[model samples]
Target: MPDTEGHPEVNEIELVDVFAALADPLRLKVVRDLLAEPDGVERHCTSFGLPVSKSTRSHHFKVLREAGLIRQVDRGNSRMATLRRADLETRFPGLLSSLS
Candidate 1:
């Protein structure tokens, strides 16, 4: 099996965490934009164009990652962010769709 050490497994992701992560408007917008992407697409963190400062944007990404709402990877000189669609779908079917 793949490592689930540092990140949440599908079953470990809680609705509360998801809800909390989505509670912020900026974070919700990030998630919305991510979900709108083609499957497997990863956008650079800075490309999201969020109004927050670098530190705040970093914090948003961290919260989303910890809440199992997104997956972030360091690519070259920048971080890439992508929605954890598969895991989220498996854990909470129709949740993302309902949010749309």
Candidate 2:
């Protein structure tokens, strides 16, 4: 299980890793949904309504977190996720806009 602190630092984020993480449609949708939310809003992992198993959804979140695209933390029994918007913008300008 990975914690919020376990994610790669913004400076340590690599383009290839981010690209690979977003290569999956599910993973890309997760990021896009987060981006659509207002700033500072953290959504629970299960709220995505994805057509996949719990474990598969967890895997997608893991990939995004490891790629420095999202920050996730345990909130009660649910895992909350927020798009690392500022961090991503800092590391790769115009990237998020292009995705939207």
Candidate 3:
């Protein structure tokens, strides 16, 4: 099911993984904040109001990224996370619409 070359049906992703990634309140908040950040303000994982330890926060972000709920990129010294808005909309229509 990994998005490998052989997997021509990469778009046939499961809803369980996607739903699981968005299940957390903190993760939801992260997405909400990312949408609000100004055009160029790439929010780091730590910028989220996650009360857990850094390790836990990292875990949450990883889950979201792996499930395609968010995108993470490494900038100079920090990792930035942004919502995969269009992709998610195409894959699961009305998914983000209900959340917002």
All candidates: TM-score: 0.92, 0.93, 0.80
Q: What tens-digit string does per-residue lDDT give for candidate 2 at 1-100?
A: 3345669988888999999999999999988998899987999998889999988888888889999999998888878999999999999999999999
Worst 10 residues of 2 by lDDT: 1-10
The numbered model that scores best in TM-score is 2
* Candidate 3, residue 42: lDDT: 65
Clashes of 1: 0
Candidate 2 overall lDDT versus native: 0.90
Give the per-residue lDDT of model 3 (tens digit) for 7-95: 11328555788788778888888777776765345678888879999899988888777777777778899988777777777788888
Each candidate's clash count = 0, 0, 0
Name the weakest run of 10 consecutive residues (lDDT summed) in model 3.
1-10
Location of the lowest summed lDDT over 10 successive residues in candidate 1: 1-10
**Taking the tens digit of each residue's C-alpha lDDT, what string does model 1 give over 1-100?**
2235235777889999899999999999999998888877999988889998999998999889888888888788888888989899999999999777
Ranking by TM-score: 2, 1, 3
Give the Å shift of residue 62 in candidate 1.
0.3
